[model samples]
Target: MSMSDLFVFGPLAEAATFEAVTVRPLDGVPARLPGYALTGAPDADPSLVVREGAVVEGLLVSPLPEAARARLDAYGVALGHETFKAQVDCEGGAPRMAEIGAPKAGASGPDWDVAEWRDGQGARWALMAGEIADHAPPLSPTSFARQKAMIAARASSRLRAAATPAPATLRHEARAGDVALRLDAPLSGEFFKLATMRLSHRRFDGGRAEALPREVLVGVDATLVLPYDPRRDRVLLVEQFRSGPARRGSTNPWSLEPVAGIVDAGETPEQAGLREAREEAGLQLDALIPIFEGYPSPGSSTDHFHCFLALADLPREESWRGGLDEEHEDLRLHAVPFDRAMSLAQTGEIDVIPMLAMMYWLAHHRARLRAEAGSDAA
Candidate 1:
């Protein structure tokens, strides 16, 4: 253990979050740092400005292990925090205080509450912090912050994945002991990430499989919403140039697909579905229906999708204009009869899997949806 005393003026002050990060009990005592004012982003790290006569209340932890202190320093560095010395009132006198970082300008708030943060975002953040620490190799400061920005979405993905029932293929592995994780390193890219790992698992023949190096693209979870107007017997679809199929040298890069978007930070799949409907097709979803949730390519990707069959009103005039211009989204909307959409799905005119799946689901449940709308109209 290294003899280092520290002052936490933010989320790190919470005992549970502190312990989770440092992997040791935090025997922190309430203390105050004088000559500083408290301010920072809510649910994130905090900052302190040196202000005469201003005092910030925080926790004072001392004599942390060298390793733990080093990890904490890395996290702070990644988060734009710089270390400074301050006087913390502990043991009825001034004690040496190692502050995390320098204060940020342009954005500041009132004193942060450890209790409120722990109550609201603590669970997911704790899990994400640990995971990020585990995979973080010393990256450039810019990369580090960018990676840090993704933790919320990562936490959401993990939580949603946890709530899902294990698939049939995964059931056997679930019944057995946890597969040995030879590696779990995450590599970040511009828009996605790659998790590299090597592992061995029990074989069906009661033998261990050889450890093999593997990599899978770690993707953000997304929402796919297919809009259907039961009263009009029409569905709204959008055509956009898909980069993936284009990269594969497909003759046609434009894909006919449903309204879709990456689940935004702190937003649920249902929220994303509705927002995407409005953004992509100029249609507002009234009520939603979940159709499917699955990994698009589990073998080599972590692209999980929450697919929904959205009930909406699609006006004929709105079919030509859609997609946010700010995102350079050149989307063209098409409003087709339900049968035409189904025929498109059958004839391979629809190239997107989510569109095909939703069309088939609508085919199966069209009668009931129509009847429900009729009753509501009556």
Candidate 2:
């Protein structure tokens, strides 16, 4: 069915979420429905529950697809036990209606608009609903409500993509000396968006030198990397399926890597790295040595993957499974000898690039790390 046939009055009425519906002037539309009143300006109006005597009014739109319908059902509209039926107008027009729990007795409000409701807590809920629609189908209002709350809590501090600014005009110039590559950058007056991927063309001597259109350049503050020493002889490596690699049709879907996490705002990279080690692998780090501070892909993504070589004491018999319970992480720790770990990296069995780099770093510093561990034990 056409999107125009759907009419959303409450949380779903926001223009950002409901692009099909517009606020442009329309003529001869019906104005009243039982128990509701239209409040505020015509352009950004809201429907409020006035009184028992008042009536709510809205236009009839199109039927929603099964997917959208399921998402809305999961939104838990408080209309009680009313059977799902077609809402027929006096002129013989009808729309599908799923009766939900009715408003509380004597419930009334001076201001109630879908846009405002969405702006507060409803926007997050709606975005989650959309995600659920995309991932899990046949959404139930109860499940949507639960997932909405969970995702909102996890992403509260992170800026939304919509709120961030887009990249502006870019400038490019060639670097001097032996390197002939051009350095492409945003012009002085331009602004870059946070946590977004960007691509730009580089020009040298007023001529186009290179075109970089596929790189994802996002701006990030810091990164955290976790290193595990497996029971002294080996180190723990986590193997998990990554969607990013799978998207590229990699032969190996599972990656062997250390426990890592993003450094939150105002948090030190070392603190975050150690915290992630504890949370992901249940390792209490002895010392965190900074290996390097650099970007993961300087040509593409904005993530600055901070590398850390964390020293930890390993017990041979201890096999406590660990991972953050909230994040649904499935982690398996392998305690293998240092030599075998290096061999895996050489053969490409450990395919993750970051882990390979860390393993190589460990190879050179293994003796020093072991001596430090022995001193700590004494």
Candidate 3:
């Protein structure tokens, strides 16, 4: 089989990402796509649009192997892009027909800047490219498309974990090569994934342990907000059905809990918290008070929670329907006095542990918050 050529713009033109997608680092010559301009946000994939006098400069990678081409095709298909042959002006060579991935419909935007993209999003894209490489072989483009969100979330999780500071003052400090891991086949789902891994880690006694198999439910980082109206001495809680309790064979699976949502691929926890508060309860928070950031079930899942106390105005509405229709959420919002909420927590009526924890935190800070509210009124 004869190898072909690919004219790539955007992050795909970069060496690291190109190598990850293609499974090897191959040299490329500079090329230009005439009568076309690149468009999209700085943080998004650049799309090609028709422009009479514009020329899009990019890399022309030749000798694209079969596997590499297949992977590239899968990537483009997953992104809702289509490949078409285009005549590209190659440096020191005549114009040649090269495959280019473009948006189905012509899109328009500012001139493409590879250097600017490198400065802003290169590292994260590189990490995500590696993830794509790992999945491109086993999964079809359609299947990969369905799991793209979770894959991006996993990559974001990796980037965050890498950048976060882990203090080992009380625990054993991990040395180089303290742990080694190899991922197995993952069970992919629409919003989450179950992954199994074989890992070996150094024991507390400083000896390396044998590799053991472990499975974990991989979930995106999320934010949870418990809305409190300090002046009114009340808090808003949302009641909704939860699958975990239902799967656990509980007779009643409807849970009274905080407003929550998953942190998107590029969004911050605070942003997600505010967005969720609006979507789940239609409340614009006056302020967001950080309560805790911890794992809900660290041993068996990657479900990290960023919990917050949202100070908001709670009217006399006893009950109201809320939640985004797009998400298929049928939530009931309840405005309960702080005392009643705490009592529910104490009596185990509020079975959601994280919400209960937040209630306790509110209890500790209630006096100060109310005093502040009183002071502001004066």
Candidate 4:
């Protein structure tokens, strides 16, 4: 196989994790191998498989250098026994073959002739599937299938740009100087729907719009906080039964997290953080420390999360079981020293990424927190 013939189908294919995996672009014409098919769960589109049967099809491309190949293999856990096979084939001028996941029997190849597939939704889905699979550890068949479905839903979300659009064009655009004048022009191709598990026509500008340069309005959403009391050398975390994780095959669906709540349309992040501290944990925050502001996942989710570090005086005798009666939040609060929280984070007792990040932040900021606590007491 020559450099030009190779094509990656999933997250590796997207070129986002190329540096992490140590794979590089090959310079040559791309050629396709005939007889193989790509298979994945009905929902996820991240990774693709090249299976043997009628004829496995793929492009022959240049091989990765030894170091790059090693890195890629480690990242994909491709080492060990013969889980997959590598072969040589020819593309533009030379012949080459590559290693890909083993294919499943009787799996059907994608219907490329379909307008939506041709426009590149399949490729995008494959990319997303690869990313999710990469992060998640190997699971049982049932669990893997569920993960695949989640990946598909995430890929098909309308919040992200479709796979095959022109490189220079923005998915949604605003005037250069105006962040609020966002415009949604007509989309050029179809969109994949996670909920329906199918490709469908996507019409941009579906809503009534005046012109290219139009005002875009967005509401200020809510903020959630987990407060840590430095003077007492204790941190507060809330435990709640989370249906989302439960549905995703988590063994213990209930989770322990910092205080959190949404910001009303016009409320500020600080206001929302303090309010949640009171509502969920029955404590008032003395000071608020900014953590980070960013989207949880720009590729799949629309929700933006702004995190805060709240310092407060927690009452030891106060009941830990508190939640809004109307919302049906069955919450249990835990107050542990900073070191113990870090130990929990290290042991995987605390698995949520946000919670882990906050724990680490506290580890570094504990001294200042303690000094402030002393000043307040004085």
Question: lDDT winner among the candidates?
Answer: 3
Instruction: Give candidate 3 misplaced runs (Cα > 4 Å).
Output: 33-35, 50-53, 62-69, 84-98, 105-109, 115-121, 130-151, 375-378
Candidate 1 C-alpha lDDT tens digits along 38-73: 665567665677678988777787767777776666
RMSD score of candidate 2 (Å): 12.1
Q: Largest TM-score belongs to which candidate?
A: 3
lDDT of 4 by residue, 253-355 (tens): 8887888876542245687788888888877666688987655554444445669988777656233688899877899888877677788899888877778
Question: lDDT tens string, model 2, 192-219?
Answer: 2222223334345555433343424334
TM-score of each: 0.82, 0.46, 0.85, 0.43
TM accuracy, model 2? 0.46
Once superposed on the true structure, which residue ranges of model 1 sit more than 4 Å away at CA?
A: 1-5, 14-32, 35-37, 51-71, 91-94, 97-99, 102-108, 127-149, 165-170, 173-177, 182-186, 205-210, 317-319, 375-378
Task: Rank candidates by TM-score, best first.
Answer: 3, 1, 2, 4
- Clashing residue pairs, candidate 1? 82-100, 82-101
The list of candidate 2 runs beyond 4 A from truth reads 1-231, 317-320, 375-378
Give model 4's clash tally.
24
Please give the range of 10 consecutive residues that has the lowest summed lDDT in model 2: 186-195
Clash pairs (backbone) in predicted model 3: none
Stretches off by above 4 angstroms in model 4 are 1-220, 317-319, 375-378
Clashes of each: 2, 25, 0, 24
lDDT of each: 0.74, 0.51, 0.81, 0.53
